[model samples]
Target: MALRIRNHIPGLTAALTILSLAAVFAAVLGVIPQSSLPRAPEPLIELIPHINAIISTIAVMTILLGVRFIRHGSVRRHRAMMLTSVGLFIMFLILYLYKVILKGPAEFLGPDVIYQYIYMPTLAVHILLAIVCIPLLYYVALIALSRPIEAIYESRHKIVGRVAASLWLISFVLGNVVYVMLYVVY
Candidate 1:
């Protein structure tokens, strides 16, 4: 069964990644009509950024723990942690898109110097890594889901997983940093 799906992984990964990226861009760019979606309460909409910040923080910890677990040969624990991280990532994305589609991206209240020198650069790198991560993450996760633990070792899981995890951690951490710069800082 897993072997059958193995052959189609690349196709599946590409299709899903493209669709995911498209939906994200559509939402962010306002191509997705806000009137088409049900609206959340004002408070819930406002709380999404903070909620996603906490989710991103948890995802960072989970990615680190997942890597540590795998290194220590605790594959079951590692799988659990990694899957948890993915779940958190999904939750964060849904909440974020909802807010962005309804309310638009958050504005930075900091000074121009910080916005130009720090915020823009940080956001650019974070968005870049996040876009890069989508395919890598989908590949590794699909490989893991379609294969048994023993077979996963034979696939490109380790190499891809390492890259995905590294970029994923950096992306999530930078997301939290962006959150702070927007919501907490001047």
Candidate 2:
């Protein structure tokens, strides 16, 4: 009889754990009243355009980290960056969705003229990318996690990793751009 082993990556579980926590936090926040919610820096809009600025900044950091990890040829770190980016976006999505679910989908900010064009595309693309990317992430995670040791890193993981990176970057960058246009520009 032979024992079987799966492919292993050192830090992926930890990254997932952190992401899970963020997701859970967002979900929890959704059902609770603001008075009952844990304190953060104030809610995003009340904090002003600075919140969008921060998310956009993190989006840039995620891209830079991802590119560096890929160029350096660290498959492990590359996966970490992608996972982290996805994790952050998950956090963003949870918050974004919570706000929408709680507050309704129309903007209460920016001038009417700019808000009209500004949000329509960003909102459509953000939503479309989200719908598409969720399934893609599931499959990519499956491809990464389902294989055995040698199969994990040197083979399927690379393909899945590339797909994950591209999808996540597009989603994240577009999300921030949408945020900027709505909050910062107009």
What count of clashes does model 2 give? 1
Superposed Cα RMSD, model 1? 0.9
Best by TM-score: 1
Q: How well does candidate 2 match the true structure in TM-score terms?
A: 0.61
For candidate 2, what's the RMSD?
6.5
Query: Using lDDT as the measure, which candidate wins?
Result: 1
Q: What C-alpha lDDT do the candidate models reach, one value each?
A: 0.94, 0.59
- The per-prediction tally of clashing pairs is 0, 1
Worst 10 residues of 1 by lDDT: 1-10
Question: Model 1, 1-186: lDDT tens per residue?
Answer: 777778899998999899999999999999999998999889989999999999999999999999999999999999999999999999999999999899888888899999999999999999999999999989998999898889998989999999999999999999999999999886
- Looking at model 2, residue 60 earns an lDDT score of 55
lDDT (10s digit) by residue, model 2, range 55-142: 6568658757976887897767866766676666656655654554445343537777665776677767765665555655655565
Candidate 1 local lDDT, residue 118: 99
Error of 2 at 51 (Å): 3.9
Off by over 4 Å in 1: none
**Candidate 1 Cα deviation (angstroms), residue 171:** 0.4
